[model samples]
Target chain A: MTGIDQTSLSRSTSLKLFGYHPVVIIVAVLLLFMPLIANDFILYQIFSWSFMLGIVALSLMFLAGYGGMVSLAQMTIAGFAGYMVAIFGVNGIASVSIGWPWWLAVPMALFLATLLGTITGALAVRTEGIYTIMITLAIAAAFFYFTNQNYAIFNGHTGINRVATPHFLGVEWRSTVPFYYLTLGFAVLCYWVTSWISRAPFGLALQGVRDNPRRMAALGFNVNAHRIAAYVYASFMASIGGILLVWGNGQISPGSVSVDVAIDNLIIAVVGGISRPIGAFIGALIYVVLRTFALDVLVAFGLDGNRFRLLIGIGFLAIVFFSPDGVIGLWNRWRNRHASVSTVRQGGAHG
Target chain B: MRRFIERHPLWSLFIIVVIFVFLWLVFATWPPGFEAIFGKKKVFLNAVLNGITLGGLYFLVASGFTLIFGLMRNVNLAHGSLYLFGGYMGFKTVAWTGSWLFSFVVAFVAAALLGIILQYLVFRRMEGQDLRQTLVTIGISIVLADLMLWIFGGDFYQIQTPDWLVGPAQMPFVTAIKSSGEAVYMTYPIVRLAIFAASVVIGLAMWLVLNRSKIGMIIRAGVDDKDMLSSMGVPIQLVFLLVFAFGAGLAGMAGVVGGTFQSISPGEDTRFLLASLVVVIVGGMGSIPGAALGALLIGLAEQLGSVYAPTYAVVLTFLIMVVVLAIRPQGLLAR
Candidate 1:
């Protein structure tokens, strides 16, 4: 059996455990000091936004890369969690919110969001490829419409506003430094968990299912269940990001769950590199930076600021056309070329 | 009748009766109990008629979507943008020349040319890669949408149909009975009828070309087995290009027709695209008849829901889609 290669599997697992690259350490160190170096706007608006968006994109990356399921409902799932928080937790819209404590509301919101993701996953796993995209997109569209219309719960199009952030142990989590740390901690935890999962047996089996489900099934794997499980894990990650996002914005609105945002999640995951978790963060950084600055640049050039999406679209197209594997793929190619060049130089010296 | 009923267990008859009762309640009872819920009976009739015409417009857009998907396996998310672009072009042409026919032709040609460019530049390179193609099309759509907003100034615009089709036409068959037992005749916009007629003609023409012509045969074969068709010297790329252009041209035509009756706004691109998606998904992907059927169901659901439950109109179509998908995941008419 293909699963019988125990020696190579153990060796690979050990290598993964010990393979702490220097670049990762350097990047981590830099991120740890970001809030200290950056100003309030930079810390709150750019970095925190990037981390939250990155977390959601990372969840999408896990599903698409490992489960072969390109779901368009990732944003919808995030939005659902945000809505749950708004409904259960205290908010400015006091009439609508039930005003539950953070300790109780957070888990309840995450639970409901996870259930929604599992149900969607169960429905979506029946289809393949393009149909899967259609189904997830339909769900996203439906959710958007439902929330936009259902005034009793979602407060109609305006959504619930002024959602209060968690306050515990005399820490004002909404402050820049504390919020940044909170976001960073969650981001790092998610990234680490996703990386660990990628090397785990279930993740390997899911990848097998992604490449060839029939072969994986022949090898005694329950493909759909595994896919559903992946969705659950991804939903938890996205739910956490969504809670953070709502706190960051201090609101939850129907606009936040728009189809454009859903598509943006896909674009972020794709532009970063769908195969790796780190790529999602890298892509989020690029996207947030561009979104923040591109409008200013456009207005400076006497162009319309509203057309910033045009530049982003163009960038996405160019990136996809040039490198389908995204920024990570480009990095890998460059590294390979550098390694080959050095080896060639060494061979010449030996000759 | 009794023997037939006995053989079929009366389920069909019961369904017909239920439908008739629903229609009666919707169309013939002014000041009825539902008036409190769904407005007046006149509004219900208008909604039904409106739904039929809207379904026709939806069919015009979705037929192209289905054709492309059936032939190339490419889900062109930019389709809605194409529709909106064509509408804008048609609007400009009409403004310039005041000839609805000329505007229609110009819109079709421009959209077809754009489609050709898209196939060669973007979709052609991605070929069978569905995810990449989807992303590329989305990118193209975003740029096109932004450009259109820039040029069109984010205002809602509608094409003016010819003077001959501007007035309302009296419908002899549609008579709503008031509570006083008086018959109230209903009138519908002539442009709506024209739209329905145009859609029917387009649907028939497409059916003929797909079923009768040699090119149609080749397209059908390609949809079934692309690799086999290519190996048999069919020049599948040429067929794909032709199909893509033709599909895009159909969307342009739909834009013109839809623009005549409804306002074309910046957001209409995604709306039409979403409608077309719902149609194809419910009717069955890659099936022309399925697209038509699905469009009709969605149109009726949307209109009826708007009248009965205005707040939930959008959700109604989605509900239909979800129900259909749950019951038959391959859709109603999967090819």
Candidate 2:
């Protein structure tokens, strides 16, 4: 073999053993063994909530990162799916439910959620930048109001409760271990899909559209169509996360899709790293952990637990002000600095 | 005929009025036994009056939004927070001083000071970047909202109106003709009329400033072309700062006015913000007249929708926005 071929083969082998990276194995092992070490609260509250919210943020990240469209309607779409589940599937409360099986209801909810997102995308695609934000925000506000007022389908302010999770083959999915694994599996699948799509031809085209829509259009790509398609994919992911969220909470209310929660989704994506897929997960983990513990930290200081949002808001502001690229960007910068410093030290030693 | 109609849009307005009259007549005579959901003609007139007052307040809030947004291309999502903050401050001032005028002035100055601080601290750092501006403003809004909630507590607060504007005013000209041909008069709150008057004065002052003053010219020019205006040696940044302060102060003043009639609550900040957005969107983003018209339309739609379909009152504004956007994306009076 040529010298180049031999070097590349060795590098590839060193990088991966048996087609699995060390990091992957470590992560897999941790995920599989996490329930063994952690209690129900940690597994359910921290991990499960983090995974679900991370999935939704990942959807926003995909659109904002790849498609350059920052949609505030993501939570609205997710809420719609949750509402769909409550309405279609058997719930403990509300006589309005259609009483459909989980198999039939889940797919239908997802499809309807996707359709709603696609319609919003199509409507908002004609606008640019701040206008897009406004339009999506308007849609979100409209959805919130509609759900809050229309007692016929949505059951008014107090949303449907006791939405049943999937149960089949003697497996109660809502249980701690099963639910944790289920959420973990979905989170992993979403992350993989996001990363895979980022490398896909369509995703590349969408990125190109994001960077320069006029140029992409000049190159014969349908910019609006690509954006709408991205919304579809993102909406599907958000729908899955929403369904998972409803199951996790055992209830879905108008509060679930409030303007604050919608804005929080954006915050999660931004604080993690808008342009990085893994950043969503990282950001969500931080947010969840902070929300869970910050109250305790505050109450200990003789402050109100409700002041948690103040801390979050301040942190968000500081993060945005100091590093607009978020935590992942900060990490990358630190790593680069370390690498450069070590290289300089090595050069000095050689001299 | 088409060319004549196109040339004179005012003629079309007249035609629209005629059509509206016809629709009213039809509604009055439809099915020969249809009863108005809004009770009698007196109630209908009262709803219309309420709508105008609400629209006037909306205009006061939205005008500032349009000015700042139009001039600087900055979307201050915290505009509503400033309003609520101002209202709370006004409420506190009234509680302390027992003077409505003092509270108004305090709210205005406080809101303006906060606006200046926001511009200097958060907005200045991320100039000309839309997404960053949005995120930063959202952050500020959250902080302000939480702080207000902590200080004001969770309860709703309303400002007490002055003694002079406390009673209802008789409206002799506004009467309902019943089937028995008896004329029934309507009376409106004097505070509502004062609010309407305030809106008119503010609107007129804004028009005069925007149209007749040199600074107004500079602001208008900046809105049209910022780089060009800056290159012409105008202090664009200073102008933007002033505009931002002025706009925020307007919101604060509106809050005081709104608080006198409507209760101030936690979520009202977002509500006013959304209202301003709808007004600006319907009225054409930066146009003063557009904001006025948009506010009126929203106010009317809201009142009418409430009278007819109380549950879907809020949806009417969204519907108007959607229809306007779909037909005229730039808004009704964009230029």
Candidate 3:
């Protein structure tokens, strides 16, 4: 065998044996070396925000991909968790402030957030497709205006502010490098769990329900129970994201959990490709990059920065128009094309 | 009397009327007396009038929303973007021509064209694919909103009415009495009165079209069953496109009229969008009369709510939405 051929074959075999898709392996390598290549701000913006939003979007994907429920209320859950943290800390308008340490507060907040999600999920899962979306939207709308107006409990329209980052192991988790690492660890953990669950029996059953619920029910699966469980699982991921988002922004406001934010999560998930967990991270990266950089580009052209939204809207429309499967689908198509070209070359050589 | 009462359900009717009357009397008498005794500004009447005008504008927008939702069965989340787009378009046209007549013509045509293009490009392809379409259109709406922000900036812009229709007119009864004992005339803006008239005309036109026209019959039939209509060779796609465009055009007209009455700003998109959604939910998704009635309730309620409790104005509409949904999941006028 030729020297180059031997090396290539070994590399391909190693990728297979490690059970790492080329995309995942590359991403892992990049993330491992990201600190070396990127400055602190770049790391925070690209790695941290991507991971945080990815985690949030992952929750939505779980609902959309596994449970066959497209929930717009994921942001609402995150926002709820965020508000819980602020309220429990010194910022809440309610007279009842917990003032608990991060260890207690975060867990409590996450738990409450999960319960909120489960309730929303329970209410939402009763309907399917468009109705599911509308109900979640209604719930989200209710939560939004409630937060906007309920000054006594939620601190009203301005929302609660100055929520402190959790101090874990005597380390301030909000520091750029530390936070990025913390986020990376969580993201990797969630991705692994998501992949693992998608392959598990429950995941298989959920898929069965997604593809055909009536048949799954006939086979003795409690479809509603499975769906609710999926929502609970998804809510856990979203709560984590919400917690991280609080740390990232240093505050939680009505805007954080607004209808726009809910829709933004949907856009990120759709942009990333709903088929996998990594899709959320990828989608978040794309959305954040577009949103962050598009401002600079518009400003450079002497155009108002606010118009960056217009560009994002156009980009989203185009993405939906062409690739309903999103960026992952595009990546897959490119990979498939390369695979075909290589296979054709191999056939020619053999002949 | 017992037989007549049973046949007419007089007790139930009597209770409803009595409650309504009691509520109205309490609202009318208590607020003024409290204000007079407490030496507070008797701003309640003025606020209600203002709220009515605001509600009238909302009705125009929400009626469009209800029409599209009713016929197409697609909750175009981007409807807010369209509403904002119309306002921006009207603003631009007014900027260009500097004439009210030309501005109307330009705004209407521009908005209609925009509606047609959006329908042809985005919504038409989303016919059967509901979820993706919603997501896609939301993106489009955001982009459009951002585009407007880019073009117009975040600053609020006011559409100037004609010279003849500017300013407010004098009223009689409320004006005659004040703390100073001077004649205080209740002033109403001419532009707002014109908008109300225009809306009535537009609503009448729509009612006639839907109730009378053959095309309207086809549209009603299409809404009933797109598949059944298509099977009969009724170009369902075309009908959807038309409906989407028509809805967008209405949004545009409302924006132009709304801009003249109330200032247009970047944040107006979400506010009006939510209001329109509320209207559809309250009015019953496909019912025309429901949109009008829902609009009236929303408008009056908002005015009255703000007058009585400024803090509760936002909650009032949302509370109404929740209550309506709980009572009738199909909405106030759903078929």
Best by TM-score: 2
- What ranges in model 3 sit over 4 Å off? A1-15, A18-26, A29-37, A90-98, A122-127, A134-161, A200-202, A213-229, A295-307, A337-351, B1-15, B26-52, B93-102, B163-190, B230-238
Model 2 iRMSD vs. native = 5.5
Please report the TM-score between candidate 1 and the true structure.
0.92
Looking at candidate 3, what is the lDDT of residue B235? 85
Candidate 2 Cα misplacement greater than 4 A, ranges: A1-21, A341-351, B1-4, B7-39, B172-175, B178-181
User: What TM-score fits each model?
Assistant: 0.92, 0.93, 0.83
Cα lDDT of model 1 by residue, B85-189, tens digit: 889999999999999999889999999999999998778877888877887888898889889988898898989879898888887644557568787677888
lDDT of 3 by residue, A77-145 (tens): 988887787767654344635577777778888999999999888766655777677667766776887
lDDT of 2 by residue, A145-200 (tens): 88898888888898899888889989999999899999999999999999889878
Which candidate leads in DockQ?
1
Point out the higher-scoring one by DockQ: 2 or 3. 2
> Which 10 consecutive positions of candidate 2 chain A have the poorest summed lDDT?
A1-10
Clashes found in each candidate (C-alpha, N, C closer than 3 A): 0, 0, 4
lDDT of 3 by residue, B227-294 (tens): 88889988877877777777887787778877888788986887777777777777777788788877
